[model samples]
Target: MATVTFIPAPAPDHTASLRAAVRYGVLGLIVLAVVGSIVATLLAGMPGLYGALLGAAVGGGFILCTALGVLFTAKLPATTAGAVLLGTWLLKMILAITVLAILKPLDFYDKTALVLVIVLSLVIVLGAETYGVLGVKAPYVEPRAAGDAEPGEKDAQ
Candidate 1:
C-alpha cells in the first residue's frame, strides 16, 4: 500500500485581505498628514506662503516615511513592521520641523500662494499613491498539471 501525504492549501482570501489592509492603511496615513498640516497652519495664524511651505515639508516627509515603512515591512519580520514605521515617522517629523525652521529665513511667495502649493502637493502625492495601489496586479492564475495543454493550444501526440 502507498501512503499519500496531503498538503494544506493556502487560505482563499488571505492575500486579498493583506493587500486591502496595506492599501487602505497607506491611504489613510496620507490623508491624515494632509489634514494635520492644514489644521496646523490654520491654528498658527501664519501667512499663506508660510503655511504652504510648512505643509509641503510635512507632506513630503510623510510620503518618504511611508515608503520607508513599506520597504521595512516587506523586508523584516511581521513583528517588527509597526516599530519600524513608528521610528521612521518620528525621524521624518523631526527632519521636517528642522527644514521648516531653517527655511524661515528665506523669502518665498506670499501666504496664499504658499498655501495653495502645499495643498496641491498633498493632493498630488495622495493621487499618486492611490493610482499606484490600484495598479497592483493580483495573482489569479492557477498552475497547470504536467503534460496538460493550455487553453486554445493543441496537444502533441
Candidate 2:
C-alpha cells in the first residue's frame, strides 16, 4: 500500500520579479542612450559620442552590479536580498567614484555630457525598479479584523 499527497508548487520569487524589471530598465536605458547620443551629435557635435559611451558603460555597470547581487544570493533565502542590495550598492558607489577619478585625468570626453547621460540613465533604471517592485505580490497582507473601528475612534459602550 502507498500513500500520496499533493502539494502546490511554490510561487515565483520576489527576486525573480526584480531581476526581470531590472533587465527591462537596462534595455530602456540603452535605447535612450543611443537615441540621445544621435540627437546630441546634431546639437553638440563631438560630445555626443563620448556621452553615449559613458551612458552605455553606466547602464552595463548597473546590470553587472545587480547580476552580482543575484548570483551571490542564489542559494540563500530571499530574506537576505536586502543585505545583498545594500552591499552591492556600496560597491557600485565606490566603483563610480574610482571610475570618475580615473576618467578625470583624460580630458577626452565632455564632463557635462557624461554626467547628463549618467543621471538620465539612473532615473530610467530607478523608475523601472520601482515599477517592478510595486508590481510584486507580497507574500502576506496584513490581516484585517471585521468591523474594525477607525483609528482614534472609541468602541460604542
Candidate 1 lDDT, tens digit per residue, 20-116? 4346545654564466556555755445435655556566555645754665476577769778877887887788678757766666534444455
Predictions in order: lDDT: 0.59, 0.70
Clashes of each: 2, 0
Which regions of candidate 2 fall more than 4 Å away from where they truly are?
A: 1-10, 63-84, 136-157
By lDDT, who's the top model here? 2
Off by over 4 Å in 1: 1-58, 108-111, 139-157
> Candidate 2's residue-wise lDDT over 1-157, tens digit each?
8999987556665466657666767676778678778866776678667866786587556654675577567667667877888888998888888888888887667777777777777777667666765776655434445697765677553
At residue 122, candidate 2 shows an lDDT of 73
| TM-score to native of every candidate shown | 0.48, 0.65
**Candidate of highest TM-score:** 2
